[model samples]
Target chain A: MYPNNLKYSKEHEWVDLESKKIGITHYAQESLGDVVFVELPEVGAEFEVGDSLGVVESVKAVSDVYSPVSGKVTAVNEALLDNPELINQDPYGEGWIVEMEITGGEEDLLSAEEYERLIKEE
Target chain B: MSQLKRTPLYENHVKAGAKIVDFAGFAMPVQYTGIIEEHNTVRNQAGLFDVSHMGEIEIKGKDAGKFIQKLITNNLEKIEPEKVLYSPVCYEDGGTVDDLLVYCHNWEHFWLVVNASNTEKDLDWFNKHLKDEQVTIENISDNIALLALQGPRAQEILQLLTTFDLNEIRPFRFKSIDIAGVDCLVSRTGYTGEDGFEIYLASDKACFIWETLLEKGKGYGLAPIGLGARDTLRFEAGLPLYGHELSPEITPLEAGLGFFVDLKSEHDFIGRKALEEQRAQGIPRKKVGLEMLERGIPREGYPVQKDGKEIGYITSGSPSPTLGKHLGMALIQSSEAEIGNEVEVIIRNRAVKAQIIKTPFYKKEDK
Candidate 1:
């Protein structure tokens, strides 16, 4: 499990600010079940808050990954194409779906504690 | 609304941490660990399932055989004592009322296991039709608990506990025997396309049998399975479910179950006339298998399009655990129901390319 140092989205995606690179949290992967396939946005693709950025498909169903904040995708997780199970194994660390360059400061995102509480309510 | 019905194993499922869901007016476990894992366990090893909610009806009398022959599509004359035959009970209009397993114990005693949701309808159909026959139809579903132990190692695990020579029992064969000091009826039948057995016992004895099997088969890798994997496994095997593939609006011939319909028999069945007429005219629609050729996966109720026109709808769809491919069964027009034909499945409002393929998408090799 990843540490509670990053902001999270209600859709289960997490944003960790480490030298400007943002990644998904561990909670996202567990909720998504086994990640058989993932479709991430192309690098350099601009996105606004709530924009559909990608899709994560499990054996049961497919869920869309949305942009938590307005930004441009800097890099996509290329390793997910062959071994999507990495998301289930290491969600917050090596299984991040995309690295985005934040165009603006996080305003609508929930803090680590708030996101944890939100998941509990769910 | 009132709370949904619970089976005898409801508490057991909850104690085992199964995620419960509403199914056919019953609160049942959809998955224990996960659907994919439980499905693979059943395919490679063995898994136990709680199917106590399935409806069982008993018919006994001198005319029981004669009466059931006219009720279902399968020819009763071919079935001997201790043999179970799977068939669909159809309406006079050639539409399927329900798919059931008819167990012939002797010349005068038989049992029919039907879908849980169709219990009331099946009982009424039997009572209405058998009024003139010298038979008694009784709905014994509430009194019986059905447990299915399915997979490759199912027979070996079950044989260890029972005095009955299970190896002598061939497929679709069943016998009443004493196991764990309790008299129960065991059948070598399953829906998962695996070599397995289904046991019917008193509701009080269900927990004992379940616990005994788990304790005895621990070394063989037996896990408690749930309805989630059951659906995916059956879907991968191209088995037709009542509401999805076999419905009141669909005939068995159209649902790719013609093998179970014995038209060659001279016995007059309920839908024999309409079935013969349909056979002569050729089936209007046929159930075909679909494999996704594009990136997206299809789901139930999704529209199947061919050349920009809707030709069919997917009845059951899922990512196959054994094959690792997205597969589905679609009820398509007979003209478009050919293997290798290209079709498009509308998934998430996008048309994804798919191809018509032969059923049983995942084949199990001989053990």
Candidate 2:
């Protein structure tokens, strides 16, 4: 279920409204099946709204995780390097991939209701 | 180009919350519950699989055995009725046509279970090779459906549904028995490297048999497995999938299946001359297993390098669910495939360190 407080990208990533934290949505993790490994960007890395931030590897395939908004990465969840299944277990809370200092492109993200509609259409 | 085919258990898979995907032009379940969990279940407890999409060809006639023996690289003379033999049918150039299982009923009757994607092609190839031999090859793919019950607890779970003595069917042997009133050809065979049985029955009875097995084996932790875990299990067991390990471009000998090829036998198989010539001239490449010493996961099509030079590419790779180690199989230059040799696998264009290791990453202790 899409939470009401988070802003989501069309690419199935979510950015927290208050904390500016980024992670994949529950729908994204479910589609990826079992998460075996995840590659996170460094803290100092700067990226545009559509730039790829990292990768999530499953047993069968690999998918790229893209940044939802333009910003500089302030912190990354290092625990995911050892326990990537956390993404599948808890995609919204403890499985958060990175926290960023927002710079621009916040207006492009969809609200929870809008994100829910978008996934249903897909 | 046409609509994808569906097996009899397609609705059952959907009702079980399976993720359906296109496999060999058939709408098949990739997973249900999850891949790693289903994989571990098959290794430890019991798992059921609806493999009805696999192709079945019945060869019947007085020359059936001789005709098949001339087509495959393995010696079938060693096997008798109720025995199963695995072999690779090859092209005259020594390349693989397809690897299949031959279930023998007698010298004049046998069933060939082949890969789904190669059904039409295999039929054409077999017909093309038909000369003066008194053999009639009929494609019975639509008439037969396959179900596999695999794991350490398979026998105990399956025994609950039938009164037949499963112990009488030893490894590589089969029996015609009745399970829940459905007549079935039950074979002590599996691809997961676990103790299991592959049941062949009428296509119409597939869903009934599948449901009965699940209901009866539920107490034993029997879950329906999908194609996702099936690949990982077979890869971990070092069993070759057609497109990856054996193909028209890759031979059984090069794929490290030389034991299945008979080079000195009196029968002149289709590819015997070419395989013998390769043996005499020395095989150029070989399949080897690799374990990652670095972070990146080795994946199929990733370039394998040694001493900064490209040697080969990963054919099949994944994390071994049972062992919890990242492992892969690669076909590399034979000279560079020595055990203990460190190699580099290019992951996302970055070289990651790995080492050659002995294959069959997950082996059952009882075997």
Candidate 3:
């Protein structure tokens, strides 16, 4: 399901402005197939725009999940440690990776419509 | 660029919604519904594999038997008519050229089924070494299509249509059978480490047999398995693939395939002298099975470390579905290949703890 108000990254990461929570999109999880393991960033780990946050290892290969905006990791989805399949089942909802306090301009992020076009061009 | 080859079931794989990938220069299915699902289906019931990409060579002449005996490591003299033998073709230096299945139809005629990637090279080897002999080595890879029906329930499903008494067929033996009016060579051999059959038929008739087997085997829970599950299953069984465990630089002795090499047969094969010398001196590297005590899975090409230093490398690895543990096969220095020996595998630039274990990681009960 596509969220109208959230900004999205080219790498299929979605961010909600209201809660400042970030997670992978449904399209991203679908393309990656089954999610077996997820390596999450530690709390208080600061990242700049386009920084490597963590990795998501699927059955096929490992993919590096990148940060969309500059922020510090305030909270992480620890449930992924026991149930990585949650990302495949609901990537956009409860599968959110981290809740961060946005420290940079939100204008740098692309709108959901722009991200849809970006994935279409691929 | 070399052109990609397609098997007779290429369109069929596409129609089945398979993820196509280039494997050994052939466009083949890597997965369909899912790897784990297909793998479990084959283990529990039966699965059909499109193996047309494998190379088939027909050797026919008066001295075919003697010629093959000189070329391969196995004791071909023990192989009877209508039986097959699995052996490794070695180089003059005792390094493995390829592991292949040799079928003896009679004294004057034989067939060799080799890995798909080594088709051209194997053909060249046969031609150059035959040395203007009376024997003819024809590359029949394009003309023949192969399918493997593998698992516990394979026999029950296959016996429904064929008139032949499959129960009489012993392991590693084959016979010419008529399936749906098509003449096919059905062999009681497979790579899945299961009681199964590998059926070889004319390329034109492959589709007919494939559809027929699928339809007939539906009651037996037969699924169209892809290459992904095939790899996982074979890996769990501790079977070596060509490019992985057995390479041109690695000998059969080092690869733990010495059982297939008839060293005591008193036959002078091509690599006999080199192999004898190597056997006496002891191999430099030995292939061993590794099981992770740590969390991470050691993948192929990952360096195996000992006391923070590299000693060997992992050849194949995956999470073993049967054992529910991360398992791997590695080629390590002979000095460090002892059982229960502590080792480390570099995963994501970090050395994870592992231990050397015995092979055949998952053994099946006698059916």
Candidate 4:
């Protein structure tokens, strides 16, 4: 189940509003079988919504993690540099790839309910 | 939506929670638990693979030996009955048609296991050149099923069902045996370099054998592997996959499988002239191994660069489970293929550093 507190992107990324935590959704991790490498955006890197901030490489495929809100990256989870599988273990918790300070006004990212509907419709 | 063909063991794959994907018009499992897990299982213990999607074609008659010798690059006369020979079937111009295994039963019957995607095309090519009235070719792909039990413990796991001594079957040797009352053709042959057996039987009885083998092999850590680990294992063992290392535009010499090409043999084949010309003039592009020094994983079609110029591209690459490194096989200019050369792989538009290293990232001991 998608977390209720997080804002979702159509590309299967999730963003935590209060803590500004960002990571891929559980569905995204499942679809990309066996995370082997995670390339996170460096701290202080700036990007707009829909910009490719980082990438997640799985055994089967590779996908870019798009930014959900325009922000300057404040932090990156360095643990994933050695162990990329934390994303598979906890996509919403320890798997958080980046923390950013939202710069501009927020974009109309999908709600958890809307994301669920989108997945079901797919 | 339901048009994809399913193998006889489709239900078993679904029951095991396999991730199914469309490959060669067949709904095949790409992974069961995970690629790395299944791959390490095959390296350390044992893993079973549903290779039934491979096409099996039988060439029979008095002229079978002569026709087969003309079709493939390897010398057919060197192959004995109850033995296996790996060869690359080529077009008239020296490009690969398909890399296959020829199981020679006798001068009257020869079985070839070809790539699934090339079945129809290969059959057409075979018939179009069938000038020998004494020979006949039949596509028996739909009637048979293939199972590969591979690993260090493959012999131990396979000995549970059959009364025949598995030790007598040497590498590349095969025999007819009865397993659980069903007749089967068991061979000590596998894509993985590990010691194992490849069994072929009637398609209808595939599920029963699959389930029974898994049940019997439960103690030996036999896991049902998929196409993901199959590619990784074969790649690590330096095997040339049909579509990856060998293609319509790729010759066996450039793919680093020249050992199988019998250029000096007395028999002449379809691509002999072109291959002889290549041997005399020297090969242009050749396959080489690369170990990524950077963080990115090199994938197929990623351009291999040198001094800001495109030299070649990757053919097959993965995070090797056995070696625990991001490795790749690239076909590049033969001039830069020497060991210890440095190259760059263009990953995500950024050039990542990689080092050319010795091939066969993994090989079984004394194997």
lDDT of each: 0.87, 0.94, 0.89, 0.91
lDDT by residue for model 3 (B62-82), tens = 989888988899899879999
| Residue ranges of candidate 1 with Cα displaced over 4 Å | A17-32, A44-47, A103-105, B128-130
Off by over 4 Å in 4: A104-107
Q: DockQ scores for all the models shown? A: 0.44, 0.87, 0.41, 0.84
Scored by Cα lDDT, where does model 4 land?
0.91
Is 1 or 2 the stronger prediction by TM-score? 2
Residue range B122-186, candidate 1, lDDT tens digits: 99998888767899999998889999999999988998898888988889999899877888899
Pairs with steric clashes in candidate 2: none
lDDT, model 3: 0.89
Residue B267's lDDT in candidate 4: 85
- lDDT, candidate 1, at B22: 81
Each candidate's fnat, in order?
0.36, 0.86, 0.00, 0.86
- Alpha-carbon RMSD of each model: 2.6, 1.3, 2.1, 1.2
List, in order, the clash count of every candidate structure: 0, 0, 0, 0
- Please tell me how candidate 4 rates in CAPRI terms: high
Worst 10 residues of 3 chain B by lDDT: B317-326
Model 2 residue B335 CA deviation (Å) reads 0.7
